[model samples]
Target chain A: MPKLIDFKLILTNIPDLLQYLPITLGIVLLSMVVGLVLALGIALVRLHKIPVLNQIFTVLVSFVRGTPLLVQLYLSYYGVPIALRYWNYYNHTNFNINHVPAFLFVFVAFAINEAAYNSENIRGALLSVDDGEIEAAETLGMTGWQILRRITIPEALVVALPTLGNQFISLIKGTSLAFVAGVIEMTAEGQIIAGRTFRYFEVYLSLAIIYWALTVITEILIRLIEKRINRFRVAQHLVGTPAPTETPIVGAQVLASKEVRS
Target chain B: MITIEHLAKKFDDHQIFSDINLEIQTGEIIGIIGPSGSGKSTLLRCLNLLETPDAGTITIDDQQIVAPHITKAQRLKFRQASTMVFQQFNLFRQKNAWENVAEGLITVKKIPKDEAKARALQELDRVGLAPYANFYPEQLSGGQKQRVAIARSLATDAKLLLLDEPTSALDLELVGEVLQTLKQVVLDHPNFTVILVSHELGFVQEVASRVLFFDDGRIQEAGTPDEVLVHPQHERTKQFLARFATQTVHN
Candidate 1:
């Protein structure tokens, strides 16, 4: 039988596949930015338990989270245009589905999927902020938005960072699903190269190595960011740093004869 | 001056406190002592509208808010009039000591950054935390954190300051330092009124001008510490004092 894997071809295919990295990175970065913004709104709506909008978001997030990403891609690709066409016809607008770029469907599908998961992360992080801190801010006479901006969001972001980094990395891998929408991203390009070369084992091996490297690189960068963000916390746990005391009020005031330690 | 009249609060079917009336003069240090779940903290909270009373009128200086009828403007005005020091020493965890002290000044009172920083540093110095001003809350001992909390309250220059169990969360060694700082605060800032909720009868007797003994969701006894702490009138008050006395002796 022929060799199950051709090691030479795997080495040669590495550069050809590496070029597709930008396509994967582009989709992931765009989806992350859009997804994070939308997630904030969605998280707030549910957190405040707004009258009706919260329930609508509940259904939307549930649908996206419950279904498979591939199915979501199909729905975005096929379903969104039909819905938009009906929307245009009924509203008497001259909009056309052809005007929407095909790749936009992939972006929408991945972005919405990431939003569904990240909203929970954001919401949980915000909720984890101590009730005492919120009370402290209020007692300090800080307005609600000021407290959110200064106290709540900063503390919550610290709590949410690692989880958010994990979600972003997952989203990077998730971009491989973009091939479902006919987007020529990394995995899609790999498939085309493999079909032409008939060296499936070598091409597939190269693809795996590229993805492994991407995951490892993303993890290292995220760790560095986390360390920078939590630098204060790092200093907090160091021991033997003597607490320096300010001088007593009276330069010549004698200590009280009776020390009240009760 | 602070006045609370016919104050009431209820959580669903459980009544927390009702018809609570109090009058505090400027510079008065009133100690509140009670068993757990006596609504002492809630009473303090209602003064600043932190926990809106179901029925009552709270007046600080001239701004008065009636329960269930307070406007947002009135709420803000009332909240601005007082500051609270929590048992947890709820210094903003993300901020260092100076920022925690200066945040209210810069954001609420619109003080200039340079001026607020100077004032914050002075307050930190007052609390004997000058050198630790750059440290985060988690870096400081519980006593240091409480001192920072006290400094933050003092820096706001609020007419009334409420402290809920300031030393209850501290180590035995730490409690003495915090109590000393508090005594200094009362002596130095004679114009600032204080309501301290505490379990340390010795400290309360030493520092407070008056003591209020809370029981059954009401102030059963209110008198000079000599009367309330030394010469209790009500049977419940005597029982409560007796229990605290034994606990202290055992400790």
Candidate 2:
């Protein structure tokens, strides 16, 4: 037999990969938190189009999305430090202690970049909301903020969730870029192993499997979320067939109530 | 009372209307009878400022109805004064019928929750939808949806209610329940004003004090129902009434 391809090697690497899991999860979790906050700001800016800021936001969103994310990471790690160094000297070398942390710079780059794309997705979802829905809310006299909280974002999230889920899968792959900034994530650790053992194939294969498992698990979680939000849609179609329509909203409320760990 | 003077609307290449003038006296039901592209829906939408007309003056209860456009703040306040109900029902699918009706009252009027629910219950009772209050709009029939919509409008305490083809989506049997609800509103309320855009001539005659027959986006015939519907001077109005008569015959 062709030397009994060492399944033992794959099994051994599983524990090694597990060690780096927290780092990967941390980057992704941090990126999503920062991205979501920025996206909400950008989304509202574009959606409501608050004066001159709207045009600036559109350009910003377009510029960020139009470029490759890898290039953005490079610009932050290399470019921002140069700006910081100069600004520090201008402030009498007070900033010589590094104005931007490598992790922080990477986080900001990924977050701002993700927010640009997320704002676009979120804006599309918000726009797809029928005018009647908003009108109904306004007529009910839901204050602008209340409507945003009770109806607008809740409904927009349902549409954005799937697209957001896809983006998160991309984010898993994206955390690999954290390796460039020496973040000690899965891919970074994999690189260390590969360099020491000169075992390029094994190390990279382990990295791919870990990323794949994360994406798969995230995908399953997203489906459960989608099923819950789609309760209203399901109920709407069940015409005259005496089954519950409130299931979808109730399910959605349940999901919404579940505290997502930051 | 609502007064619309020389209201003109143009969209893209085609002009919708050039010179339209009308007045809606308080407690009167005005039915706009028109062909498909005659701007009937646009006219109704413009009244509540749902659609922005190019150049016109609208006065609702002497409020000047002018943002000349529906400025966001002005529009919000205007929405409080009037409400439009589409044939589509336009109920929030996420909310139940009672919540849908109570929505505007609690939000716009800033009524307390207990008071809003009480008022919503009263409004629902008026529309004969008290039983379906807890049920969602999705659970109700088309007639029931329209009734809930009426309850929602009533809960807002709006002076003018615009109905866009209200019964067009309902079954023949379902149509009566919705029309009856409106009739009850007309009989009981003294200050309420109604504008109904419908293809149902029999229903229009039963409700409207005055009928304006429209063709090609202009009022072709305008008078009392007896003058416009029965003794139509315009061939278009005669043709329209004939089509409804034929539709009735075929069914």
Candidate 3:
């Protein structure tokens, strides 16, 4: 029988798989940027309850969240060419679907999926801001846009950072699924190496090790960012001295010495 | 001067206040005292156009805002002419004390950063909070936070200041510090108009030039502090004072 486990193969497979790491990281970074912009748009729509578009996005976000990401990936990979063909037929345009990169399909699917999840997180963070602070800003003559940019968004960002960091880590891992669309990332490369060598268990274990290392690195970076962002909160616990209890000011003796304003 | 005519507001079916008419002189410290839900806070909010009055004409200095017909520019102008200090302090949590004070000058007035910072520090100094200018709201005590809020309002250079239950949220011991700061503010800027809504009858009587007793969506009595607080004539006013009297004795 062939060796039950090719431990040596596992070690050798890692170097070849590392070459595809850039593709996976690139997808995560680009998708995160695009996903955040789209998520903010969706979050604001839901937050302000904009008329018809709100309802449309509400259903769209719901659909994306409810369906499996794998199914969405397949739909993006297969659905875009048909969509472009119809567009070209109706609009008399010569946009060739064949020229579109496979990575584009993978990117669209991942970005939309990420957006649906992050929009809720963003909306919750936005809502968590105190109404009193907004009112105070308005009273100070801050325009609606000024209040949003200066006060609301900054405050919401602090609340959203940790969850957003988690989302990014998940995105890094989720890039493994890019193989579903013909774009060979780290995991896909691992699969190819395994197929040629027939060291399936060893190759899969190496891929797991690579993913585990990526997750660990991502976690360390997120924690550092969280600490930096929460610098304001660090000194907060130092203060809370016990307040001296005095008589409630319901009706203390109206002091004769204090000149009554007339 | 500020003049209000036929000011009214309601939430769905409940009427907050209606047919309200009042006149306020520049430099006057007008105190409004009322029971909970008597619409005193809403009345203060309408002066700054924070809450739209269902029907009314409000004239603050030369700017006139006729409700239900206010343009965005008119509303902005009205808010710019006055500032408010909330009971909750409402200092921007992300910003330090100095930033909270400077934010209005920098953003609304469009002043240069260095000039705004200087003015903010000056305002903080006036409130005896210059030392704590670098502290965030979470790092300050309740009294300190309210003082920072007062500084922020003062820094805007608004002629009229609206304080809605400013000390209602403070600890009993902390209330004296905020009231003292307010008293000093009144003395320092005698020409700065203030409309204070509070349940602290003693503080109102001490600082208010005139007092209005509100009940059942109306100004039941408006007179000198002695007339309104000590020698109330209206039945509702007397009944309200009587409740406080009972509480004072119980405490």
Q: Candidate 1: which pairs clash?
A: none
Give the TM-score ranking, best first: 3, 1, 2
- Global lDDT of each candidate: 0.86, 0.78, 0.89
lDDT of 1 by residue, A1-262 (tens): 9877789989888888878888889888988899988998899889999989999989999999899998999999998899898998899997888888877999899889888899999999999999899999998888888898888888888889899999988887788888888888888888899999888878878888988898899999989987876755734342224542443422111111111111
For residues A64-107, write the lDDT of model 2, one tens digit per residue. Answer: 98888888888777877788779877887666535445777778
Among the numbered candidates, top TM-score falls to 3
DockQ of each: 0.41, 0.23, 0.37
Interface RMSD of each: 6.1, 6.3, 9.3
Q: What tens-digit string does per-residue lDDT give for candidate 2 at B24-77? A: 899888899987889998888887766678887888885775535656776666
What is the lDDT for A193 in model 1? 93
**Where does the lowest 10-residue lDDT sum fall in candidate 2 chain B?**
B62-71
Model 3 has fnat of 0.60
The collision pairs in model 3 are: none
* Cα error of candidate 2 at position A242, Å: 8.7
**Stretches > 4 Å off in candidate 2:** A1-23, A37-68, A85-94, A135-152, A190-213, A235-262, B67-70, B111-122, B130-138, B233-236
What is the TM-score of chain A, computed separately for every candidate? 0.85, 0.83, 0.86
| Docking quality category of candidate 2 according to DockQ thresholds | acceptable
